[model samples]
Target: MAVRISKILLVASIGALLLLIALDNVFDYNTNYEIVSHVMSMDEVPRDSVISWRSITNPTLHKLLYGFIIFTEFAAAALCLAGAGKLWRERRAEAVRFNAAKNIAVAGLALGLGLYLFGFLGVGGEWFQMWRSATYNMQQAAFRFIGSIGLVLLFVHQRDD
Candidate 1:
């Protein structure tokens, strides 16, 4: 197996991880949730309704979600670095190990976030929200796509070079 393919995959994975981190940095859920809640209440609640902190930020839930998103992003960052180093060192064989880990990680990210977006959050009915959802899904799918590439490279590495 050759390290060339792994090097390419490592670059792609790093790009994807950086993209995800950038996205997380740019978007703030406190604003998004409030906006959504406002929209949902538009057809029902009166214009005089009061907007409170509870409607904006659920402390406990946010705590849990904050930890989850941050940890996942952090793991992604670490994996990206590890993959890059493995590729730089031309560890085609060991890159296979990183790829396997990446495949699982991306699969989990896609499944978890996809479920949270469609099933739990129920986003996408209008233009802004739709764009946001698109960005979110695209970023997530990027991770999974890179993971698939990693897996393929791993299989390639498993072969005789």
Candidate 2:
């Protein structure tokens, strides 16, 4: 039962991570404004009206970017689950538990590496895009830090009955 749950979560997490990468690479400058205008009840401009980057830039992307981060973080959380499951199943076998934890920690680090690459390589636009791009970069940095800490904790707290 527990193993089944772990498998489900693991697969879901992997899917979410992949989707987040795809969204992070997406650059739809025009659609963003239309969505924002609809959601926030902003008045539409005349066809010839010139909109500043600040005006057209969808500050609403903040939510979208945060969502991407959460999805990746959830995947990392799944890695922790995989490690914990191994430890739980082989509580009496210290070597087995340690090996399981080490392996999952490595996997978590690899997932973080992928997230970093996605964020780093995906951003390309004018200054209007810079705000979200910068935010995503910071998010990638923070996730990398968290991934490092999570792996360190797994190694530090490895134990057996």
Candidate 3:
């Protein structure tokens, strides 16, 4: 029962974190949007003759991509919150039932991990060379998100049985 409650707290905490992030992104739109814009545009990266084609300079496209990211963050948060609620409600159930209640939270964490690892690290970092930009680099932040969420994900995945 203690373990179940702890798991609920961890999952809910992640959900709250993601919700805050999405809220921050929306409320402080220009700040994070600028970061995303710079990463996508590769404006801060040193000109590499071979990699010039990877840059996306279109403002409309940048806005679209940023919107998509914000939407994803919201979705992950909602799913995680819902999952946490489910887990809490089922905390006193049998072990198998409690274990079964973890699916949504896992999906939420997986979405977050995917966003940080694949979206930021793979697409932004590798494809757009975001790491080369001292002003716009997001690799470190992305890694932190990935690592933290991943750890929570692993912990939540533990079987109550």
How well does model 1 score by local distance difference test? Answer: 0.44
Of the candidates numbered 2 and 3, which has the greater lDDT value? 3
As a TM-score, model 1 comes out at 0.39
Ranking by TM-score: 3, 1, 2
Q: Write one digit per residue (lDDT tens) for candidate 3, span 1-161.
A: 88888888988888999999999999999999999888988887667658978899999999999998999999999989999999999999999998999999999999988988999999999999888888889899989999989999999998888
Better of 1 and 3 by lDDT: 3
Candidate 2, overall lDDT?
Answer: 0.44
My TM-score estimates for the predictions, one after another, are: 0.39, 0.36, 0.97
Best by lDDT: 3
lDDT of 2 by residue, 1-161 (tens): 34433433443344355445435434443443343233222223323434332333355664565456556656765664565465445544455444444466456545655554454233312222322332222444435644644444444344322
- Which stretches of model 3 miss by more than 4 angstroms? none
Encode model 1's per-residue lDDT on 73-159: one tens digit a residue.
Answer: 555555555555544455445545545544433443344344334433443223123223322323354446445545544543343
Give the better candidate number (1 or 3) by TM-score. Answer: 3
Model 3: worst 10 consecutive residues (lDDT sum): 44-53
Which is the leading candidate under TM-score? 3
In candidate 1, how many Å is residue 55 off? 13
